[model samples]
Target: MPHYLGIDVGTSAVKAILADERQNAVAEADVSLTVSRLHDLWSEQDPEAWWQAVQTAIEQLRAANASAFADIRGIGLSGQMHGAVLLDENNRPLRPAILWNDGRSFREAQELGAKHPELSHAMGVIPMPGFTAPKLLWVARHEPDIFRAIRKIMLPKDYIRLKLTGAAVTEMSDAAGTWWLDEARRDWSDAALAATDLNRQHMPDLVEGSQPSGMVRSEIAAQWGLQGDVVVAGGAGDAAAGAVGLGAIEDGSAFISLGTSGQLFVTTKEFSPAPEAVVHSFCHAVPGRWFQMAAMLNAASCLAWTASLLKRDIGDLLRETEAAYRSPSNVLFLPYLAGERTPHNDPYARGVFFGLSPATQQTDLVQAVLEGVAFSFADAKQCLEQAGTPLTYAGMIGGGSRSAFWARIFASVLDVPMVRYQGSDKGPAFGAARLARLAATGEAPEAVCTAPSILETIEPQPQLVELYRPRIEAFRNLYRALKPEFVRA
Candidate 1:
């Protein structure tokens, strides 16, 4: 039987999986990655590191199941979005990739938004520091030498695509996050590109996420012991790939992704722009579809940060916090460790633990950290509602979704049912595999992108929901109270 390979170039790690024709994961591997934060509000990674990680992951996958690896017929890619991977004329990275969480371009983003107010609706959202366009503006202003030499710009996963196929290509879903795509037209917006001092030449060739981008290079195929003519699908950005993983392709289908960053995403058949509400309206991975998303820059990474700071195992801390959870945390946390993106769009905002007392323990802090992330999602949910896509229920997926405790907190805080699917934690890599299958077989999306079997449905407990309501308000008010300080500091 033919197999498909999925590769996710994530912020935290590179994950690759081999899946059989039935979409069952036959083998998988993960290689950890590190981000460099040499300056405040700056997050970057060397693109060469990503290439190395992908190679390592592929090697591990091949070692895990040699037969399945050799039988791979197609590959799909997914990765963190909006990362600026500037390339010189030789297709070499100009510098470390400016990541999605990097907030160095706040002023540039504001200027772009002010100068091109009309482009917001066409581009699907107002320019933000995290988007690729503003990053380019920053480079143009700060690093003129590098900017002048730039011949191409690619998203994180597309950079890997270039390595795999020697083709500079991108798909609609990933392009949509760059603040350069006309969301309604599903193509690059020349006007938007011009505002950033770039034109179509700076961008890679576009393809639909389900379409074949290129064939895997012959040397790569032979080195990995692959079969003949393996096609690479035009894959999605991480969020859209997560949505695809959850089978959220139809109108009104909604899901929450609690990855390094978080997103509350809702699918729509028509283009929906809600930039005023700070919701991202972007193309879905599949053709002729769009999604409205409320994106939060801080999510699971906050938990990981706290765990690393406290020098405790995340699982152990979570269990202790769950045991100690009698009511809402007395302490309120603003999970802006890497700054915020959703409602606030405040890059200066820093993480805070308010209402700490002498009686507070590590467990309380841990609970607060988890609650703070969920509270951000609550803000995201409200933003989605404001954007006219209210969520009654949402499928949940990501590393954080492995914790039932976190899921419970989210369901109560959002006041909606949270559906967890079997192997949901596999997330984007699994979705990429499905896309690979679609690209290889020319299958209908509805037939191949079916939702996995539900593992459990987590519904909000009325009492907890009522309790969380006030806490959620307090969470909002606390942020409001600290807004000035966040800017001043």
Candidate 2:
């Protein structure tokens, strides 16, 4: 049986998965990574560390299933979106890669919006501090020496691709987040690049996410005990690839990802940009497809933080939350722990807990955190529906999908069924593996990209949906009332 490898370079860790032709994950491994926070609101990670972690993950996979790993015919990559990795003429990193959660380019982001009003329309995304364009602007202004030395720039996964293939290449899904791609055209935008004193010369060559980028380098192939000509697929950014893994590639197909950050992804047939609402319209991982996305910078992280605050294990907090599901909590939480993206592009936005009282207990606070994330997704779902695609149901992926309580809450809040699939918990890496199979065997995406077997489907509870209706409004109002204060602080 032939096998394919998929590597996902995430913010917290690098994960590798080996899957056979039948779409079963035969082996898997992960290696941890760290994010540096040297200053407030700044997140950075060394790209070198990511490459090391990838090697470690692959080694672990080889140790688990040597025969399956050696039979790997292709490789695909997926990673966190919007990170900026700058390289000098010698193919050396100029500095630490600025991460997606970094907010140091807030002023630059605002300036881009002010200077180039047409940008949002062209790129199908609002200029945000986390995008590559503003990060370049930040570097040009504050670190001119490093900026002058820059010769190539790529997103996080493409950086790993460079190490694998000796080429700097990026695909549509990841490039779409850079604020420098002509999303409708699926290529680099000269006008968008000019906003940051850069141009197509600084950007990597672009390809559709499912196409072949290049072959694995001979040296790395030999070390990994793989053939030298193994094809490398032009893998996608994490969310798009996750959609692929869920087989949510066709128009109207949608998925909700509840990872460290949360995202609601809706696939569309046309490029429908909604800049005013801060919804991202970008090319999908599959060829001849497009997608609209709404992202929240905090999701499961909020629950983890709450658990820590309560001095309890996360499992304990979740158990207590499960018991309080039927009993609605009056306390409302704004999960802007890392600011927000969809419907509000304000980087200064902070998390807030409203309606707390002396009677509130640990369970109430835990429930509030869970409900708050669900509410945020609901907000994004509303915006996406208004823009064009209406999501009546979607596949759910990531850590939060494991929580039965939170899954039901999401279904109720969004008023839609949420399907959790078997073998889908691996998220992007699993999707990347599917792409690798395509690259290796020349299989059509529609044939190979079938949805995983259903694990369970959580349908909305009518009573809970009605109960949360008013609370959704209060959540919106709280954000509106607190917007001014967020800006002031």
Candidate 3:
């Protein structure tokens, strides 16, 4: 039987998986990556590092199951969105890739939004520092020599695609996050690109996520092992790829992705722009669908950070905190470690533990960190509702979804049913695999992109809901109270 390959160029790692025709993951491998934070508000990675990691991950997958790996007929790519990878005329990276979480371009983002007020709806979201366009503006202003030498720009995953298939192409879902794609037209917007001193010539060819973008080069095929013509699908941004993985293709399908960052995403039948709400409205991975998302910069990473700081293993910390759980935490943690996006849109915001007393223990701090992330999602839920897309129920995915305790907290805080699926934690890699199958078989999306089998549905506990209400308000008020302090510092 033929197999498909899915590769995700994530912020923290490069993950590759082999999926059989039935959509079951046959084998997988992950190689870790590190980010460079040489200065405050700056996050970067060498593009070559991602390529090296991808190569290593593929080799590991091959070693684990050489037969299945050799049988692979198609490949799909997924990656962190909004990264700016500048390439010179020879297609060499001019500098380290500026990542999605990087906040060094706040001034450029504000200037773009202010100067092009009418373009916000057209671009689908207000120009934020996280988007690719503003980062380019920052480069033009700060690194003019590199800007002048730029011949092309690519997202993180597409950089991998260049090595795999030698094609300069991107899909709607990923391009939508660049602040250059016209959401309605599903094409690069000249006006938006012009605002950043760029044109369509600097952009990649655009395709739908389900469509075949290129074929794997013969050299790569020979390097891996025996394979026929292997096609490369136009994969998605991480969020859209996760949505595809969960089969969230129709209108009203929703899910919360609690990865390094978090997104409360709801699918829409048409292009819906909610710039004022600080909600991201962008094209879905599947054709002719769009999604509205409230995105936060911090989520599972907060727990990881806290665990590292306290010198405890994450699983042990979570288990200890769950065993000691009672009511809501008396201490409130503002999970703005890397800064915030939805609602607040404040890059200067820093993490804080308010209401801490001498009585606070390590468990209390851990519990507060978990609740703080949940509370941030509550803010996201409200923002999505304000954008006219209220989620009644949502499926959960990403690394954080492995914790039932965290899921329960989210269910209670959001007052909605949270559905967990088998293999949901596999996240964008699984979704990219499905896209691989589609591109290889030329199958209809409705036939192949069905939701995975349900594991369990977590419902909101009435008592816990009531208990969290006051704390949610307190969380919001604390942030409001500290807004000025964050800016001043």
Ten contiguous residues minimizing lDDT sum, candidate 3 = 220-229
Please say which candidate is ahead in TM-score: 1 or 2: 1
Model 1 residue runs over 4 Å out of place are: none
- Candidate 2 residues 405-483, lDDT tens each? 7888989999999898886679999989988888778889999988988999999989989999999999999999999
Per-model TM-score versus the true fold: 0.99, 0.97, 0.99
lDDT per prediction? 0.94, 0.89, 0.93
Error of 3 at 242 (Å): 0.3
Model 3 Cα lDDT, one tens digit per residue, 1-489:
999888999999998889999888999999999999999999999999999999899889988999999899889999999999999999999999999999999999999999999999998899999999999999999999999999999999999999989999999999999999999999999999899999989999999999999999999889988578999999899999999999998999999998999999999999999899999999999888999999999999899899989999999999999999998999999999998999788888999998789999999999999999999999999998888988899999999999999999999999999999999999999889889888888898889889999999999999999999999999999999999999898
Off by over 4 Å in 3: none
Please give, for residues 1-489, the per-residue lDDT of candidate 1 as tens digits.
999999999999999889999889999999999999999999999999999999999889978999889899999999999999999999999999999999999999999999999999998899999999999999999999999999999999999999999999999999999999999998899999989889999999999999999999999888888889999999899999888888999999998898899999999999999999999999999999999999999999999999999999999999999998998899999999988999999999999999999999999999999999999999998888888888899898999989999999999999999998899999999999989988999998999888999999999999999999999999999999989988888
Candidate 2 Cα RMSD after full superposition onto the native fold (Å): 1.4
Summed over model 1, clashes come to 0
